[model samples]
Target: MPICPSCGAAVAGAVATCANCGHPTGPAVVPPPAIGEVVVDETAAPGPSPWGSGRIHQDRQWPTPSRGWLTAGRVLLAPTALLVVLATLGSTIAGRGGSGVDDDPAVRWTVHTFQMWLQLTLTAFGTPWRNSNSSSFGSSTSGIHVLPYAVAFGWLALLWLGQRLTARARAAAGAAEPTGPAAGAQALRTGALSAVAVLLLGWLSTGSSHVDEDSLSLSMQVTTGPAMLPLGLSGFLAAAAVVLAVDGQGALRAEAARRRWLGGWLLAWQHAARVVGALLVLLTLVSVVMQVLVDQPFPQSTFRALTVNGGVYLFGVGSGARAGVGGLRGGHEGTFALYDLGAHGGQWWLTVVPVLLAALALGWSAHRGRLTQLDRARLAVLYAVLTAALVLGTSIWLSESSTIKGQVHEARIELLGWSVTSVVVAAAAWAVFGALVVPAALDAVRRTPVPVSVPLPAQAADEPDGIVGTVELVAEERPLVGQVDVLDSHAAYRRPDAS
Candidate 1:
């Protein structure tokens, strides 16, 4: 019997997968060559280059749990402290006494610090809710209004830094054999841990609130607990994404084994995941621009505004708005309204256009691959529908609303289901159309014939020509042909040139 290379467990000589750790045993079980035969490295250099470069670099190992945590702490601490200082400085500059910072300094240093860590970690999604009250009925909001593009830049930097930290930790710890656990299982574990950490941090931080006396007098609570469920959910997703990317470096020798376990559906899901991840990041960027162009009256609550707006942009969900005005009688007439497709087409285009282009590109790429026409179409449809649903569901789940208490006239807020339906329908149509057409168009263009220029030899000034032989050829031209066909062409032969 042969032993499992990954876990040192016994395996039958013919078994392909390890019984203990699931690593593929095939790659490790190749028979040795016969004694007389030898192999040579034809591409290898004769010796080291003059600059002294002959060493091959090793792959970075995955960090263990303890190392990963230690790295997370070091990587997160500086940013958290810096953000805290910046938040305080910003408040001081704005003359608001750092209300955006935690109410208690201790909380700011510990609980809020972790909150900040979670916030930056989840920056790829959007900024965390500031939980502050709105300014007077129509005053400028005060909290940090993080732009989506900026957050994206920060998130990318964080990703690079995080990966680098893990690499350094792994290098220090020395390379070791991977445990060969399932990728999905590893991702789930890290994602769950991150979510729990965020939830606990939010819960502990919520105890200290930055009470807004002015907003409270108006019968509104400005500061409250962080949106724990949403935060945890976002954290879990963010962590999972990072974990998957990191785990990509692991189990290089076991990918075939992993693939055997993961069938066609899993393979398709992986592709879908890539598209959705890209869409999310792209939409986040679009949402940032949308926020800038469409100014909101509530500047004091800009943090929540960006958060809600980002959610709406990503999901296509509707939102509610309340307005108060003076009535003919003594009382104020207030109205509440919801727009399923709350964002304007102009704003929606900011999202729709990029996604559409991405879809078309994806279709073309798929067409170039081993997938069949049906596979390409199915994938395109899958991507389009899923993208739309993601936006719709996110909108419904993460929608935001604020209350108004000022006196004014008739106010009305109504839900427009048809608009939401229209949005969804439009998305599906765009996706299906793009999926079917873009690749076909690309293929057609690729097949089109282009005229090639030929150079004729220069005539000699004084050369004697003698009749050598004569030849005739037939030629014909056609506008276009789909399939390959031989065409007749006319050719003429002349005497040979003598010099």
Candidate 2:
């Protein structure tokens, strides 16, 4: 018997049109039984979503990367508060016999550059509160710098402002949903690249001592979460929540225009700044070399200050699941011991290089619409390795730490040298945090609804053929209980296109 082309109903093999819908059907596969998730109507013309349903779409057109009014505003939102403090500090250093802080344009510019970094660092705390104490974090900074938490909060506020503006723009554009990356994608890449520059600075500034040393570490006794998560991560989570809230409802139609700018610019900016911070660190090496040439100049220690920091990241991240169980036992102490980067830190850069490359590749993957389930799973593993390498490298650097006795020694050159090195490295780290954050934000920018088209997937053809059919096994008479396939058990026929 022939099935009606339109409705896939049995037609005694001689029907012209479907008696059900009074429509003609073409060379498409016969409809299947009313089972599983999909229900096919032979007579209806398919639209993107179910009749009135709205879903986010991925394709987007970009705006001008630079020179936009909104862009300028967004730029100012960050680095404003930190710049003010850095400028004051830089001036005080110069005014108080700090030659490097003297009335020099380069020095001033460097200070400006450094301020950008300082802001990011403070921002990490997510809020500002004063009362400097090295005892614990998310607490007072002894009024030395703005409270870390405050800085973080400020960053959040500014970021939200930018988002609000962008959301408005999306609304004006008639977008039915919120979707798109933030503006900092480029900065994220810049931060990643800056890692290399920091290494070079260490080599240039300090007359290289390839030895290990003991340093203070709180990590040995505790396991903790990231002190501060980039606001962008929060943003990504928010977007995912919203996406879930309205799955197929047309209510989220406004998200379309908002997602256009989402994706990896912040990474680039951060890496770029990190490069500059690294240069400042190299000045320590310059101070040492200069001291040798003329009088003894400023002297600074090596990379031994990050042990605790690195240990914290590793202990929390490596075996996070077992941390609690191990914590009760003494074996889970998170203290970072002496670490060696084989060949006098020659391999240090190797760790950094691969991470940079991975970030770029991931960006490309996002560009290619490959952040699907499988791709995302693969990328997650790649990121874990990259993060581990970073933690390892930083930990190793702690083996050469230069201690602070709280006195001006080594002709003040040493003090200046150390100050520069500390700030520079800190700034580089600042860049990194921002860089990573930007991508999280951008990737989250996919608020626009995606449209799923029907007609079956392209791979429906090429199966071995026997027969193709549909069965509407309704439970009107015999109700379906528990779970059952309901349709043909063997699915004997191949795809109609294949046959």
Candidate 3:
């Protein structure tokens, strides 16, 4: 077996891995000679960059508000427009003539594609929950509903993008192998459970029959329909904003990092995601405005008597359909009060969070200030909490704004739900995220304790990157240990004694 340099273990000659230590034992595992092998693999070891440690670039700037707004505007623009336009098209052109993909082949195909995409967008059908809701919680969707699925789908996309950025940061630092594959597998496993739970919640949201608590038939329409585009858009916009915030670096330093194409892709995706985000925001805003300010009629039906696991469903005229697809008078009311409260509580108050984050994100660009893990975590926590709160509040409003028998417990539960959601959001932002960023930030700019001067590579002499990556890349050709020139002949022969 070949000697194992990594583990210093003995093994049979010809064996690849060391039998004792399982280290690489055969000839150095050379890269294939196809497309010029990348000789170095400086897995981000737990040490400083070649630059001396404790020396974060002394000159740093703050992220500003203008950039944040610009980013946010870009992110929300497309989705908003799409929702409004699609709803209008659906109303004027498609007409709600059929139910459950029972329409034209084109309609069926389109809906099917979107639905499948949503299903696979986030954690697969078997992933775990990221929230406090346990595996036993109830869901508010049912029978091929669209809003929740779409929102979930959009969120999945947004998160995937952001996570990719974080993943790159790890790779650049030569730290650890990316474990996103594992997390993805986990999410996929947990998703199935989440879907079932959420579906129950959906059924509750719709009230089994038409929401009949009020004369306004808005509840019935919501209960009977799908609101995929708007909700999906919300997730997309929010996710894009977050990814833009505290996570993009390789792109920011693309030229220096020698990744022009990748950098271009990042900027392009961000712009694309943001445009969609801004559009969605606008559409949602318009829909809300139409419902409350435009005085549109309740386009949905209303009913007061529908039982769900013994729970009742309320009716409403709230943002009647006349306003727009995403208008204000949510959908259901009464028995689904908890959901209503949770949903709207999230919506009405937290809109400012994203705006604030976007501002911070763009500000960073102008200031040339990268977020410390702590700073980024703080911001992420704040935004994530707000986002969740908005989701809960909006969901509640959609499900139970007009209750037939709104009770004290229901009100308490609603408020409690919101409060709990807010706190959890805050906590998650500060805790789990905080720990992760510390390592990542340090990996980016931390200096080495034993600083050694590095020579410049011929090609990279005037390049923006410092000596670190190049030095590590050349470490193998120039080994760290070498034999002394003048060893004594007597010492060389001393090993002959059978010690």
lDDT by candidate, in order shown: 0.44, 0.31, 0.32
For model 1, what is the alpha-carbon lDDT of residue 442? 69
Cα lDDT of model 3 by residue, 220-276, tens digit: 322332233333343444444444332333224433235434333333334324423
The reply for model 1, stretches above 4 Å from the true place, is 1-65, 71-161, 164-204, 207-223, 227-237, 248-301, 304-355, 393-424, 448-499
> RMSD per prediction, one decimal?
23.0, 28.7, 26.3
Give one digit per residue, the lDDT tens place, for model 2 in 194-220: 223222322222221122223643322
Error of 3 at 365 (Å): 12
| Range of the 10 consecutive residues with the lowest summed lDDT in candidate 2 | 409-418
Give TM-scores for every candidate, taking all chains together and pairing residue i with residue i: 0.44, 0.22, 0.23
Model 2 TM-score is: 0.22
Candidate 3 colliding pairs, count: 91
Ranking by lDDT: 1, 3, 2
